[model samples]
Target chain A: MALENVALEHVPSGYGVYVGFFRDVTNADFLHQQLLSRNRDFEYAFIDASSVISRLHLLSAVYSALNTLLVGALRTPNVHSEIVTSFNTNNNIADAYRRWGITPGKTKDLIVVKIISPTAEGQNGFSATSARTPEAIWAHLTEHVMGKPVPVTDSEIAQATDWPKVRKYYRLNGVPALEKVADKAEHQRKMEQLAIMGMALRGL
Target chain B: MAVPHQQQHQFPLPQILTHPSSSPALLITQGAEGRLYKTTHLFPDRPCALKYRPSKPYRHPILDARLTKARIAAEAKVLERCWREGVPVPAVYAMDAANGWLMMEWIEGVPVRQAINEYLGSGESQEGQEEAEELGDLMRRIGRVVGALHKTGVVHGDLTTSNMMLRRQEGEQKGVLGGEVVLIDFGLAMQSMSDEDRAVDLYVLERAFASTHPRAEKLFGMILEEYGKSFKKATSVLTKLEDVRMRGRKRSMLG
Candidate 1:
C-alpha cells in the first residue's frame, strides 16, 4: 500500500505516483539537509501535513505539476519540488517551499509524495525502467523516512489540517458565499472546492 | 464532436498546455464564432470549460488574432464581474487571450430548456396546484438571477433558455426542476448601463419562450413581476421591456 501508487487515467502514460501520510516524523531535519545538499536520491516531496487540508488538496498540486510537466511548463526546478510549491496561490517559488515544505523542528505530521516518470533518451541518466518497481521505491522510502507510513485518506488528512492556516492560504475569508455556509462539513467541502479552483487559476 | 478548428495548419499551441498529448480538449459546442471544449485547466481533478476561438481561415492572421483576443478578454472580464457581484454564473478560472482560450468553472446541471420541456411534457397542469406554484417559483428564481445580472451594469446580449441552467439538487427526483439558476454562455455579453440594453435582454428571452414554449409564455409576466422586486432599477427595466415588446424590438428611424 505504501509503494503502490495511484494512476490517474487522464494523465500521460509515463508517470506513476506514490503517496504516504505519516503521523510522527522526527527526521525532517535530515530530510531538509539532504534536499539542500542536492542529494539526487532524496527527490521526494516532503510536505508539512498541517498545511494540507485533504487528499484533494494534495492531489491538486500533483495534478498541476504533472500537467505542467506534460507541457514542459514547469515553474520550479523539477516535478517533485513543483508539487510542494503548487499549494500556494502565486508564483513566489521560495515562499511556497518555505511555507508548505518541510522544516527541521516545526513539522510533525508529514505527507510524502514520490513521482516516478520515464526520463527522455540520454536525459537525467535514468534507464527506461528506473522508477517502475514499487518494491524498490517502498524499501527506499522506509529506509530513509522516519515514520510509520499510512494511507492517504480524508479522515486521516483532516486530523493533520490546520484550518486557520488553510483558510488564510486560500483566501477563504474574502469569499462571501463561503462565509454563508453554516454547516461545518459543508463549509469544509466548499472550502476545498474553492481552494482547488484557486490553484487551477493561479497566476491568472 | 465537430471537427476542431485546430486542423493541420494549426497555429502554434499555447504555452499553458505543456504536454503534446493528442488534443484532450473535448469539443462541447461548435457555435458560429468558436468551439467550446470541456478539459482540465491545470489538473485532472479540476474540470473546466475551455472556449477556443479558432483562428478563422477566411480572415487575415492579424485580424483574426485581434478579434479572438478581444472577445476572450471581454468575456473573461464580464464573468469576473458577475462572480464578484454574487450573480449565479460560472466563475472565470483562467484565460490566455493571445492563444484564444478561456477556461471557466464547469457548471453541472440540465439546461433550463430541457427542464422546462420535461416539466411541461409531464403534463404539469394536472399535477395539482403545488406543481404550478413550484414552476412559478422556478421562473421567479430565473427572474431574480437575471435581475441581479442586469443590476451589475452588464447585459447578456444573447438571452436564451439554453444559456440558463437549472442545477439539480442533491437526491432530487427526476422531472422536478428546482434548485439554483446558473446563467452561462457569455460570449456575446458586454458592459451596458442603458435601459434599452436591459430591455432588449428581456425581449430576446420573451421571444425564446414564445418560440419554444408557447404554452408557458403566459408565465412570462410572473418573471417580470419578480424581477421588479429584485432591484431598484428593475422596475424601469421591466417597464422598458414592455415598450420594447410593443415596438417589436425595433425603434423607427423616422424620429
Candidate 2:
C-alpha cells in the first residue's frame, strides 16, 4: 500500500515525492473544500485521478511544479496549488481546478501527492520540516482521505483515466503522428508524448 | 549552469528559469539571432533543447519582439511538420513563441563536421581503402537526410556540416563515422517545395564541405548520388543544383 519516497532522476537533489492512488474516494468534496479554504493542515495536492493518463503524466506535472517553485515563479498560492495547475494547458487557475482538481463527490478515484523536501513547506503552512517522513505522510493521508490507497503504477493509472476526456484536455485528437500509429499501446504512448508536450508548452 | 543569482552573469536568462526551483539551464550556443540552452522540458529525466531569442538591443523593441516571436513560431511549425512526416528531425515537444524559446527533443550526437574532421585527422592508416569507404558512407547518410527533408517540402536554409549530426549508434565506437545522420540548429529552416530553395540548400553545404574539409570535398559527389535516389522529384532538384553551382552561392537580386 505504501512505497518509499520516489526520487526523480536528474532533478535537483533532495526533492523526493510520494504518489498515492485511491478508488471510491467518497470524501473528495471534503478534501476539495480544504483546498478551496486554503487549509494548511490538509496540505497534499489532491488531483482528480480520471484526468491522469499515466505515472509520467502525473509526474510531469509534479516536476514542473517543483521546478517552478525553486525558481520562485509559482503562479498559484503555493507549490501544492501550483502542482494542481501545472496539469492544465493554460494559466487559468480556476479552470485548472475544475479540470484536474478534485470535485468532492464527483472525483471518485483520486491521485494524492506529497512532496518530501524541506523547500516544499511553500510560503505558508504546517512547517513540513519535522513531519515529512514517508510513513508520516501515508498515515496523515489515509486518516483524512477515507479511501483505500492504490499503487501509482502505469496500469493502475490507466484504469482510472478517461481517455476521451484526456484527449480533449490535452488537444490530442486528430494529431497526425498520434493517429498514424495503429497499435493501441503505441498509440497511447504517442498521445502521452503530445499531452506532456502540451503541458510543458502552456505559457509558450 | 546559468544560475540567476551568480556573481558574474554572462547574459540575461529567460524569465522561465529565474525561479529558485528552476532547474539548471546551460547555454549551448549564442548565435546572432539568439542563444540555445540544454535543459529539461518538464521532468528532469526528459531533456530538451531550449532555443531562446533575446531581444535585440539595436532593433526597436516592438520590431525585435515581433521578429523573435515569428521566428520561434515558424521554426516550431517546420519542426512539427518534419516530425509528423517522419523526416528524422527533432520533435517539437513544446514552444512559447511569445517568450522566444522553443523546447524540442534533445538530439544526442556529435556534429557531422566534428566527426568528419576527426576521421580525416585520425591519421590511422590513411592509406587504407576502408577509410575512404567509411567516409563515403557518411556522405551518403548526410545526403539521404537532406533528401528526406526536401522531400517533405522543407528547405534547411543554413545547411552546413555542423547543422548535420551523426547520432551515436549502440555498441558503435566513435571516430569511425558509424552513426545515423540527424539534423540540428533549425534556427534558419523553412518549409518550401521550390527547386531553387532546395538547390541553394545543397549548394550551401557544398561550399561548407569544400572550405571546411578540403580533403572530404571530393567525396561529396556520393551525397548527391544518394540524394538523387531518395525521391521521385530529387533528380530535378539535383539538376537545379548544377545550375545553382554555375550561378555561384550568391543569389542574383534580379532573379
Candidate 3:
C-alpha cells in the first residue's frame, strides 16, 4: 500500500485521533483543538523528519566519532531528502521512535506520530496504532535497525536502565536530560576545543 | 519663561534630567539611539518623551555632528509631514539636533505588538484563539498606517512592533473612534520617494512580524490588503514590494 494511503485505524472507538498536516508547526492550533475536544489530555507531538534528521545528525556528530562515521557512511549527497522520503514512506518511523525513546503503546490513550511536512507551507499528517506493549518494538529497533549498541552511553543507560536517577534528575531539572543541559562546563570545554581545532585546521 | 529654541548649533552631551520637578516622573531608557526618558513638563502640565542620541565613538567629531544634525532634521521634517497628513505619529515638541536630542508628546499605551501578542495569548501554553480575528484587524490597521506613511514620502526605517503604540481611550471612549494608534521613534526614519526605499521599509516590517508574531503570514496578508487600499499609488509600491520580498532586502551581486 502507498505510504500516504496509510490511515490511522488502530485507535479504539469513541476516541478520535486528529492529525494536523502543516508545512509549519506554528499553524497547528485548529488541529490541536480538534483532538482536544475528544480527549482532554490529548498527546501533542511534532515529527518533522528533516528537523529530526538535522538534530540527530548534529547530536550524532557531537556524541561519538563512531556514530558520526556511521552516519557519514549512511549519508548520500541527498541524505536529507532521502531521509525525508523514507520517513514519509513510514519506513523510518520505528527507528525514529526508538532513537527518541518515545514508546507508542505506552501512550495508547493519547495520539501519536504527528508527521509535519518538510516545507515552508504548513501541512500536518497524523497516524495512530493499537494498544500493544511497545517493549518488543523498542527492543527490535535498538537491537536491529539502529545496528548500534543499546543504551548507547552511560547516560542513556542510566535514564532507560535505571529509572530512579532519571526521575530524580527530571524532578531537579524540571525536564528530561534531552531537553536541559547535562554538564555545561563539559559542553563549553568541547565547544572551545572544536573552535580552536577548526581555526587551526583553517590556518586562521 | 519660555524655553529658548536653539538654532543649528554645536553638539553637546545632553544632561540627564533626574529630578521629577525638572523632568518627567517616569524615565524609560530603551532604544538603539541612546537613553529614552519619559518625562513631564510642569509648566505645560503635559507628558513628553525625551530621546537622547548618544555620541558615537567610531566616527570623527565633525562627521558625527553633521550626521546627527541631518538625522534630527529629517526626523522632525517627517513627523511634521505625518502630522499634517493626518497620520497618527507623535507631535514633535522640541529638538536639539546638535545635541542629538528630540522631545515629543509621550504616548501612554501598550505597543501594538505587545497588545496583539497579549490578545493572541502568548506563553508556554496558548490561550486566546478567540481574539485572533480582532488581532488580525489591528494588524491590518498598522499596515494601513505604514502604507499611508509611504504615500506621503516617509519611510519608518525601523518599522517594528515596539515602535508602534496603541493608546487606550478614556471613559466613554471604548471603541475604535476613542482609542488612538500612534507611531513613535522616528530616529531612523527618512524621507524617500523611491519605491526601493519603501520596499525595504516593508521588508523590514515583514521580517519583524515573522520574528515577533506566530502565524504572522495571515496577519501580514490582512495588513497588506488594508495597506493596498489606503493609497492609489500603493499598487506600484505593492508590486515592487513583491519583487523586494522575492530578492529580499539585500541586493544580490548576480543581479
Local error of candidate 3 at B159, Å? 0.8
- The digit string of per-residue lDDT tens for model 3 on B58-140 reads 98999988887677767766776675465778766444466576666678888877776665554522446635555666767
Docking class of 2: incorrect
lDDT of 1 at B26: 60
Ranking the candidates on DockQ from highest down gives 2, 1, 3
Q: Once all C-alphas are superposed, what RMSD does model 2 give against the true structure?
A: 5.4
Residues A168-203, candidate 2, lDDT per residue (tens digit)?
998776666765577998888777877776676574
Tell me the spans in candidate 2 whose CA falls farther than 4 Å from its real position.
A1-19, A24-53, A62-108, A113-146, A151-191, A201-204, B1-9, B15-25, B40-47, B92-95, B124-128
Stretches of model 1 off by over 4 angstroms after superposition: A121-132, B1-28, B33-109, B126-132, B150-157, B174-176, B188-200, B239-255
**CAPRI rating of model 1:** incorrect
Cα displacement (angstroms), candidate 3, residue A179, comes to 59
> What is the lDDT of every predicted structure here?
0.78, 0.79, 0.48
Q: Give candidate 2's total backbone clashes.
A: 12
TM-score computed on alpha carbons, candidate 2: 0.74
lDDT of 1 by residue, B86-204 (tens): 78888765555666877788887888888888888887657678666877887898889999999888899988989998876688764557768999999999999898999999999
Q: For candidate 2, what is the lDDT?
A: 0.79
Local distance difference test, candidate 1: 0.78
Model 3 residue runs over 4 Å out of place are A1-204, B1-13, B16-26, B42-44, B122-132, B172-178
Q: In model 3, how large is the Cα lDDT of residue A61?
A: 21
